[model samples]
Target: MINSKIRFVTALALAASATAVYSHGDVAPQEVDTEGLKELPKDEWLSENPYRGNKEAIEIGASAYNQNCARCHGLEAMSGGIAPDLRELTKFDDEYFVNKVRNGVQRNGMTYMPGFEDVMGQEAIWAIRSYIDKRHYEYKDKDLAELYEQAE
Candidate 1:
C-alpha cells in the first residue's frame, strides 16, 4: 500500500510539472513580445477606459453592480459571499481587470462568472468595475479599507 501510494504521488507530481507552462524563456522562442503584449494599448479598449469617468454611467453601473454583482460580490461591491470584493479591482490596471472579469479567472478559483464579452458587453463590464472602484476604493472609508486589506 505504501509503495503504491508513493508511486501515485510521484506520478501526480510528474503530470503536473509536465504540463505546458510559459515563462520569459518561452516568449523569445515563441517570437512573443512580452513587454509589447503587456503594454498593449488598454486605454483604447473599453476594458481599461476608466468608463468615461461619467456619473451617469456610474449610476447605471451601480444598478448593474447591485443587481448582478451584489448578491455574490456584496451589497456595494464589499464582498460578503464566496466571491471577493470587486472594489479592489483598482489595484490592477484596466487590462488585468477587464481580462480577469471578462475571461473569468478559473485558476483563481473563479469559473462560474461566465465570459461577459457577449452577455454584458465590454462597455458594461468596465462601467461596473468603475462603479465598484468609486464605491469601494475611490470613496473609501474605514470599513471598506478593512475589506480591501482582507482581499489582499
Candidate 2:
C-alpha cells in the first residue's frame, strides 16, 4: 500500500511538471507580412521608423503585432506581467524602439526576446512599432486599468 501511494504521488508530480513546461505553448516566432509598405534600404537600418503615422502601415502593423507579439506582449500592446507594456515605449524615441526590436532583449546570457533582424526586415519592424505607437496615443490620456477593463 505504501509503495502504491508513493508511485501515485510521483506520477501526479510528473504530470504537473509536464504541464508547467508546456504552459507557454508554441514559442516559435511568426513571420510578419510587410507588403504594401515601402521598402527600406537593405544595407543600413534607419534610426527612426519611416512608417510612423502612415495609415496603411498602422493597419498592417496591427495584424503583424497580433500574429507575432500578442502572445507575450499582450493584445493591443497592453502587458499582462509576462512582458513589458509596449505602450510605455511612447516615452522613448524611435531610435530606441528600432534598436530594441531589431536586437531584442537579453540579460545574464538568457534571451528575454529573440532578435527579429534576421527574420524580419526594417519595413515589418517599423510597421510593428507604428502599430504600438498608435495604441500608445489611443490610451495616453486614459488610465491603463480602464483600458484593461475595456478589453475584458
Candidate 3:
C-alpha cells in the first residue's frame, strides 16, 4: 500500500510538470501594432486609460491581451488559477494598471510578474487595459448560476 501511494504521488507530480512545460510557450510576449492608437508622450504617463470605449481600440486591445496576457490571466480576462482575474479590476483605473505593469510585483526574493514597460509601449498597454475593461462589463452582470452553466 505504501508503494502504491508513492507511485500515485510521483505520477501526479510528473503530470503537473509536463502540463507546465507544455503551457510555457503560451506565456511569451509578442509584438503588437498600435496603428490607430494615439501615441502619448514618451516621458509622460497618463493617469487614466485614453482609449476606454473606442471601438477600434477595443478590437486592438482584445488581440493584444490574448497575445501578451491570456496565458496567465486566462482567455477573455478570466483567471485560470495562475494569475488574477483582470475582469475583477476596477473599471478605468489607469494609474493602478500603469504602475503595476511598469513595476511588476515582486516579494520574498521571487518575481511574481515581470515588468512590461520596456517591452510594450503605452498605447499597447492601454489597449490591453481597454480590453480588460470591456471584458469586465461583459461578464460582471451575468448571474453566477448562468456562468456555471455556461462553463459546463
Candidate 4:
C-alpha cells in the first residue's frame, strides 16, 4: 500500500513539474498597442529605429517588453540565463537588432526564439528597442533618469 502511495505522489510531482516547465512556452503572444507612435511605411522596413530616444515610445515599450519578452528575457531586459541579455544588444546596430527580432534564432531544428514580425509591427519593435536602449544605458552604470536629457 505504501509503495503504491509513493508512486502516486511521484506521478503527481512529475505532472506538476512538467506543467511548470512548459507553461511559459504555451502562453499566447500578447499584442502591443502602438497608438501614439509615428506610423512607418508598411512596405519599407527601416534599418534603424526611428523612435530610439522618444520618451513615449520608451514608456509603451517598457509595458510591451514586460508583457511579451520578460518571460524569457527576464524583467527589465535582464536575462536569467534563459535567453540572451537584451541589454548587450545595444552595442550592435539597429539593423542587427531588428533583423534578429524579426527573423528569430533557430539551430538544429530547434527554435530558440520565434519571429515577432507577424504579430508585432515596426513601431512596436522599434519601441521595444528604445526601451532596451534605456536598459542598456542603465546596465552600463549610466544614470537612468538622465538618459533622455543626454539624448536631447
Best by TM-score: 4
Q: Per-residue alpha-carbon lDDT of model 3 for 1-152, expressed as tens digits?
A: 99999999999999999988897575656778999777887998888887776666778989988888887788898898888888887654679888888788798989888888888888888888877777876777844333223211
TM-score of each: 0.54, 0.77, 0.79, 0.85
Q: Rank the candidates by TM-score, best first.
A: 4, 3, 2, 1
- Report lDDT (CA) for all predictions: 0.56, 0.81, 0.79, 0.86
**Cα lDDT of model 2 by residue, 10-98, tens digit:** 99999999997787667676688888888899999988767767777888889988877888899898999999898887635789878
Q: Rank all candidate structures by their lDDT, best first, as comma-separated numbers.
A: 4, 2, 3, 1
Q: How many clashes in each structure?
A: 0, 0, 0, 0
lDDT of 1 by residue, 26-145 (tens): 221111112211132434555354443445556666776665666567677777656876766653566777786666657667465655554555556656665776675554553544
lDDT of 4: 0.86
Instruction: Answer with 1 or 3, whichever has the higher TM-score.
Output: 3
Off by over 4 Å in 3: 1-16, 142-152
Better of 2 and 3 by lDDT: 2
Q: What is the C-alpha RMSD of each candidate to the true structure, in Å?
A: 14.1, 6.0, 7.1, 2.3
Clashing pairs in 3: none
